[model samples]
Target chain A: MTDTLTCANLSKSYGGVVAVRDVGFTIAPGEAYGLLGPNGAGKTTTISMLVGLLKPDTGTVVVGGADLSADPMAAKAKIGYVPQEIALYPDLTGRENLRFFCRLFGLPRKAVRARVEEVLDLVGLADRADAKLDTYSGGMKRRINIGAALLHRPELLILDEPTVGVDPQSRKSILDGLERLVADGMALLYTSHYMEEVERVCDRIAIVDHGSIVAEGTRHELVALVGGADRIELTLDGDVDTALAKLRGLGGVTEAVRTAAGSVRLIAEGGRYLLPSVISTVDGIAAVTAVEVVEPDLEATFLHLTGNTLRD
Target chain B: MRPHPVLALVAANLRRHSRDRVGLFFIVVMPFVSIIFVGMALGGGAAAARLPVGVVAQESDPVAAAVLAELRAHPDLEIKTVGGEEELRAGVRGGALAAGVVIPPGSTRFELVMTQSSGSGMAARSAVDASVGRVAGVIEATRAATSAGASPAHAAELVRRAQAASADVEVVGSDTASATPRGFAYTAPANLLLFTFINSMAVAAALVESRRIGMLPRAFTAPVRRGAVLFGEALSRFLVAAAQAVLIMVVSSLLFGVSWGEPFGVAAVVGVFALVATGAAILMGSLVRSSAQPSAIGPPLGIVLGMLGGCLWPAEAAGPTLDTIGHLFPHAWGMDALLTLSRPGTGLGDVLLEVAVLGLMAAVLLSLSLVLFSRRTRTL
Candidate 1:
């Protein structure tokens, strides 16, 4: 199957300042790719070029097999973009805003309503869709902003910091919605400054700093490049002391520490691969309610590559 | 078939603007208020609507009394009786009267006191001259008869006969058959152009706000062509300005009895002026980076242009310099067209030069504005 998106050696400069340089990446169908960077790290500039908002100074962007520079309209039509800021009419209701966008996109009359309703439901904002955007909370507006991009059912969704100012609960809801989209076989190119969000949601991640892509790979592959191992957190509903003792002796676990009540943190070489053995080992000792396989801290991985923290 | 994107954008813009109460006030209310105020101030028509002129007589001679009575009875003269020449001069200077006339004891020639700065002063002086001329004719007839050795009673009878004969001659106004607009005719179209042009320019605030909030950039992201959005914005502004002009025309015609001659000519002028207004508005929208700048600057600049363009008064009334400057503006050309039509027998053919000039103005301004606005959008 063709990749959902491809960008090659893209670069952009404003006067003397180079905002992005030779930035390139690709996303496969049904995969989630994250463009990770700190502020002023060329994330937005790269996404702008990808979506045809800004023409790159050098190189090409192809969306869904259509070369952007050659056929921009067709490429643009196949991609959905949710910019960082709320690009919405504040005086208009959520439904009105959706209707306007759908109409502007030139959707057929028969399909507009159905598409709008489906996207509204996808964003979990069907209940308050009649309220004006100005009356909405920041999180609600962000959700509607995402809903607007989904109206045309584009093949690849490009989101630039979709959860910038959202509260935690709303952030989780947004992430959950996005994950469902990926599961439904839609490709996503997500850019964000939040390391945890990119680590949690992305299948492949690219770390960008100082106008260039410093590193690009899957979470485990990136961790391996920085010579870091994964951390596994196992939560027991019962008999936490016994599980902690057994967790320490697990083969893949180099070290195990009891971090909290009923929980043990294990540093393992292949945490996700070791989950089955870890689960079985803890079975007789205690009932393991949940297991979280965390790849080596992306923040540490980023800092290792750039000598600066992601937040910086 | 689907509506064009430009039409959709225009509809949305019009809807949004209509919902703005402050904008509606400027569009609907302010122009009408200015029309009524300026129309009433101009006394609204012909000789019967002329301004008040004060008269003071040092002598209660019958001829003087007759002159005063004749002045009071004249259609163009609204007479106010003062005590003497001093009071007459004071009334003219203090703006208590348009002009004042003093009849000295045994003198037929009167002292006419008037302010050169006042717009109504010329009308008052003319009325005074007509009234004093009647008194002079009567005195000449009586003195000629008495010097010819006629009886006093006979001289009085001859003077009465001469006065009767003098009233028989018809007094036609110098401007009666000419194309100059008078009274409310002058105020209506002038204020209409003033309000619509300036109001259209001031509405650029909405565009500035849209650009600032990223709505303009967002619009460009749609599948529609880029020029369509810019055209949509210009069309919306043109429609608003045209609507304002029409509203003022209808209200002034129906309520204030103001007349706009030659329907096709008037419509042509309005259409072209609205086009100019739209161009100016878009140009303003492109030039300003913030809403505050246009909101603060547009209306005042419009007022200065309106004043120079002869909205408050005729361009001829202002001196040669301002009149030349006034003709340079679209408002002055628009006023020229409407005023030409105000003549009794004028037609579309009479105002063609003004219409053609305005059309050229619209073309040039619209092109310049479109170019500047397109450049700004391209950089974004």
Candidate 2:
């Protein structure tokens, strides 16, 4: 099957400074591929090049088998791009905004209204479709922005930081909606600095830093690359040295370090299987007040590869 | 098939503007309101001031009586037939009459007595001359006919027949020597050019807003050509300015008794000026980076240009040097065309120069705006 999007050695520079360089990736049909990066990590620039907003200095971008450089209109027609900014008419109603984009994309006149309704319903904005966008909440506006991109049902949807500045409830709703789209076989290229959000929605991820992709793989593959490690934190009422020493001796435990405030942090493989052993080891030496497990995630992968947090 | 991209842009602009209530009020309502205020202020003085003139005939001659009758027929003139030249001169000197005409007994010779200190006094003198001149021409025609071997009574009959054979003539408000356009006639066109151009600059704000909201760049991602977006913006401004001009034209005429001289001439002038305004709006849109800048700067810039172009008052009121400078702007040419159209006997052909100037302004400004706007679009 043809990849929905392919960026081979895509590089762009403004003046002497390279904004994005040798950025290469492919997204398959029905795959949710996350582009993980921090601010100014060239994720937006790469997305801009992918969306045909900026011409890359080198390499190629192919959208659904159409080359963006040679046939931009055809390529653009195959991909739906939702910008990081809310790109919509504030004065127009939600319905009006959808109808405008539908017509602009050259949808059939008779099909536009039905499609507008469908997208509005999909975004859970059918009831407020007639309301002006300025009256919408920030989350609602973002939903409409995404809905506009979906009107043509382009094979690929590239959303740049879609959940930025959204309330937690709204963020959950957006992530859930996106997951539904992916389940329906729509390919997604979700770019974000929020690793947790990406971890929740994306099936695979490519970590980008300083104008280059540092690492890329499935969630499992990437976690394994980062030593397939899980972190365990144990809060105790007494000293954690006995527990820390015991954790160090346990099989699959790489290291045990005592942190501030009578707590012990253990880096281990197969954290779920090691949980019982951890509980038994700490039973006598300290009263385990609290325990938490952090599985290997994109954040860990990013930090493991780049020696910095995704937020940094 | 889908509509042309530029037309779609224009339609979108129109739809968006229709929802902008405050913008609609300033563009469509304010110009006529300004005309009404001007009319109210000027109506009292101009409507009440009639030129009083004395007419004295020393003998009971048919020709002299005819002259007095003609002067009495003039709408702007109030005639007092005094008994003697002395009384007529005294009325003129005392300001009781603006001017007096003395017919020398039974002769065709007539003397006009008035100081040409003001335009109205000169207008009175001209009116009296025209009235008496008609009578003198008839007498001269009679004398010529008599010399050509016709009887005196028969000569007089020949002159009357000739007078009856002349074509019909229309007398307009500006036909008199005092060719001042009063009240709404002057204010309506001035404010129409001023406010329509001023309000149409709001198109710049709309353009900047589109850029701010990221709508403009989003449009470029579509299949439409870039020219479509630029033309769409220009068309929106032209339509708005044209609509405002038409509204002011129709409303001022219907509400006030302001006469806009020729329909075709008026339309040509307004259409050309609207194009010029559209060009200005597009240029402003291209130059400004922030949305609020256009809204803040457009009106003041338009007003300054309008003032320089004589939209506030007559270009004539500005000294000759300033009037020369005023013509450098499109507003001056537009105002000049409107002023010419408001005059008696003016036609489309009479204001060709003004039309040509406005057209040239539109062409130059629109070309420059296109260049700048396209460049700006590319960078975005």
Candidate 3:
């Protein structure tokens, strides 16, 4: 089967600044792909170019066998995009907003009513579909926003940070709904800075930074990049910078950096055995208040590759 | 089987407008209310009362005195004496007097001076002319009697007896037809043009709001082309302007007894002017950076343009320079077309030039606005 989306060498720049540089990816049908990056890491710019909102300085995109530059309408028709912002109309009820998108997408008039109903049920907003969007919670509005994208039943769905600013319960509902969509044979390209979400929903994940994809693989394959290294997080009581410096010089500690939360995180081989020496190395500079020797994961993989935590 | 995206957009805009009570009040209710108030302020739609007329007699000529007395005796005329002809002319020109009559020295005929552009001035002229014409007839009959060798005293007695006999016999005549409609009829069309344009321009805020909320970008993500989106926005504005025009026309006609002349002529004017308004609205939406900017500026700008275009008063009455300047706005052409239709025996053929000019204005404005709006939408 043909890939649902195939983009290669995507790059964009604004004036003198480069936003995305030589980025490329492809997603098979029914597969979930995640582009993980922190804020201002060029995820949105890449998405914008992919959706044809902006012309890439140099690149190409193909959706369901249609070249985006040659046949935008056909390419766009095969893709569904849910932007990070809640883009639904506030004055309109949920049903009205969905019906409007259906008309815009040129769905058959006879099928619009049934399709709108189905999408509302899929998003789990059928009971409150008649309520205007202004009356909905942030999470509910985000669900409606997602529902709008699904009305046309595009072959691939692209969501940019879908769970940002949403309540936990509603976020869970959105994730559950998305999981069902992926299971039912819809390709997904999800972008977010949240590590757990990407790990939970994406079949394969790509760690993006500085407008380029630095690493790409499945969960186990990505963790293997860390090479049997364990992640050790240390909470220091005093002089975190000095402790970070000393920890970086330790024999077993390959990587050590101060986190945004005033803690030192280090990656080392056999971190469980190195814990005693790790505490002794920082003993004079700062007292070790807490320590956790975590096994290799995507976060450790991101840190291992980018030399910076995903939260950075 | 699906509706075109342009029509879908138009439908959605109209639905949003319908839900906004404040917007409905401005677009639907305010025009008629303004018509009633402005019509009443201009002394229209009320019972006819006594009109003030100034009289100037250069000499104490008995014939002139008799004419003045006859004018005063007429129930519809309230006569005021002026010291000289200049003062009488000034009074009529200044609108203190509806009309003025000057009886020159050693002349039997009287001069009637009034501003022809004023409806009341024209009415006063008719009343004064009737009184003067009656006196002139008596004078002519007396002179003929003298020419036949009758004594002056006998001629005077004969004229007095003739006047006494005619005093008890009253002849009522229907009022003369005018090209312009008075009272609510005049205000209805004027306010219709004013409010429709203003309301259309104000709806630019909606476009800006859509952009701010990311709705425009979301729409662009659909399978539709940029041209379809721009056309959809323009079509929605046109529909709104057309709806406002129709509502004002229907309500004014039914409630206030306003007779809009020649159906096809009125439609041509309203339809073209609606397009012009849509163009202006689209241009404003494209140029403004924020929703508040259009809301703050649109109404005041519309009012100024309306005033210049004769929505507040007759442009002709404002003199030649202003009348020439008024045509620069589409509202003036619309007003000219509507007023032409109000005249008896006039049809679409008679106001073709005005309609053509308005159509041209609409074309230029729509073309320019569509180009700007297309460029702006791409950035959004």
Candidate 4:
């Protein structure tokens, strides 16, 4: 099947300053593609171009089959964009806000009521849909903001930092809901500075910085680019020195040391898979009380690629 | 069965406004209060003091002399004698005199002239008519006696003896010429234009708020074109202005006895002026950076323009230079159109120039505002 979204050589500038430059990517149906970057790293600018809110100075965006620059209405109709801010009428009830977007998107009158209700339920705000948005918590308003985008069931959902200021529980709910949508074959272009969120939600990740994508791959492939090793920490009830020696002797283990806390910290390739072997290898020498496998993740990859932390 | 985007946008804005109690009170209720207060304070109250009137008598007959004497004696009228009927008419039209009266040679017939635009003019007409009725009673009694075969001198003598023998009686005649409504009628139209334009400017804050809340950017992301968004905003302001104008027209006519002259003419002026106000509102909304900026600046700006446009006072009374300057604002033209329609025989055709000028103002303001708005949204 054709990709749900395809954009190439997307570049935008303002007054001799480039906001986004030559960013390219595609999301096939059912894939969760993430544009991972720090703030001011051109994620929003790139999303602006993709959603047709901003015209790229030099690029082409095609949504489904329609070119964005040439056939903006058709291209835009296929995109459901959730902006970073809670962009809704505060005086309107959550349900009212949803219904308004339904009309704005020109949903069929006969289906709008049902579609709004479905979206309200999908965003987990069904019980409080009658409350005014100003009365809602930030997370609830964010959910409604998301719900508004879903009323028309666009083929591709473009979310820019969907959970920037959300409470932990609401953030979990949002991520879970998004995962379900991706599983149901809706393509998602998620952008955020939050490393863990991208790791948990994205099927393919692109690390963006300085108006360009420096790296793009699956989670394992990205981590492999930085040649990062997982650190495995083990606490022992007996024979700590001997257990450290055995861990060093293991094939995947690159280095082993005993922490000041008396636990053995081992750096290894495929540390999570190496956990079973380490536990067994240490068994004959000592009693293993606890084990934690700190796997290599996109945070390290981001830092290695951009030489800056995600928060920067 | 999808609703049109522009209608949906308008409905949403109006709905939001309806839910705002403070905004509703100001937009819907305040104009009536202003009309009543300003109307009473200016000319509609029964306790209002005496008004000046001009009189021109073309004959030296007893009837004309008696009517002139009675008018001069009336407590409510401060009468001034002018050279001719044309001078009297000019005094009333120029607002130097409240009303004018002309008595022809050898005839008991009297003509009353009043500018329809002034509430004081109406009051002066009523006072002059009451004073003329007293002399009309004596004339009738004298004619009755003469027709009964009494000589002219004896007829006069008999009427004088009858008046001295019994309590005096007064007869009133109803031969009054019509003009535009005065007093509360004048106040209603003036306040309608003033409040509608002011309210339209104030609601520019809503547009600024929409931008602040990211509604404009979100709207741009939709399948709808940018023109739809601009048109929706313009239409919303137009509906509000038109609705306010209609409400004032209806309430003033029903409760205050305001006669809006020439329905089609009144409608034409109100409609075009609403467009002018809409254009101004959109332009203000586009130019202001913050919601508070419009609210803070709109009323004062509206009042200053209203003062210049003759809504607060007659521009003609403000002298030639100010009158010319007043026409620079659309308010003056709207007021002029409504005032012109107040004349008894004036029709829509008479005020076409005023309406056309207002329509052109609306076009230019709307075009400039839409271009700025489109650029602003595009950059968002």
lDDT of 2 by residue, A190-281 (tens): 98878888888898898888899988888788888868789888888865777778778988899888877788878898897889988888
**Cα lDDT tens digits for candidate 4, B1-380:** 87788887898889887887867887788988888876764456323346778888844677788888888888777888899988998888777788888888788788889865455775676778788887887888989999999999999999889878766655466556433334566678888899899889888888888877788789888899888988898899999899989999988888886777899999999999999999889899889999888778988988888888877765544667887888999988988898778666789998999999999999999899888877776643
Candidate 2: which stretches are off by over 4 Å? A228-296, A304-312, B43-180, B257-265, B375-380
Give the 10-residue window scoring lowest on summed lDDT in candidate 2 chain A. Answer: A303-312
Interface RMSD of 1: 2.3
TM-score of chain A of each: 0.77, 0.81, 0.87, 0.79
DockQ of each: 0.21, 0.29, 0.45, 0.46
- lDDT tens string, model 1, A118-165? 988989889998887889999999999989888988899988889998
In model 1, which regions exceed 4 Å deviation?
A229-296, A309-312, B44-54, B57-99, B103-183, B313-317, B378-380
Candidate 2 per-residue C-alpha lDDT over B1-380 given as tens digits, one digit per residue, 9 for 90 to 100: 65466766777788888998988888777776777776444321223255788888744787677888888887767888788888888877766677888877667677888854433455576677777777778878888999999998899899888888764554455533334454566678878888888887876788878876778777777766667767777888888889888888788778776678889998888898899888888888888988778778878988898888877655555668988888888888888788788877788998999999899998999999889887776533
Candidate 1: give the clashing pairs: none
> Number of backbone collisions per candidate, in order?
0, 0, 0, 1
TM-score of predicted structure 2: 0.74
True-structure lDDT of candidate 1: 0.81
Runs of candidate 4 exceeding 4 Å displacement: A229-296, A309-312, B45-181
- The most accurate candidate by DockQ is 4
- What TM-score does chain B of candidate 3 reach? 0.74
Model 4: CAPRI class: acceptable
The Cα error of candidate 2 at residue A274, in Å, is 13
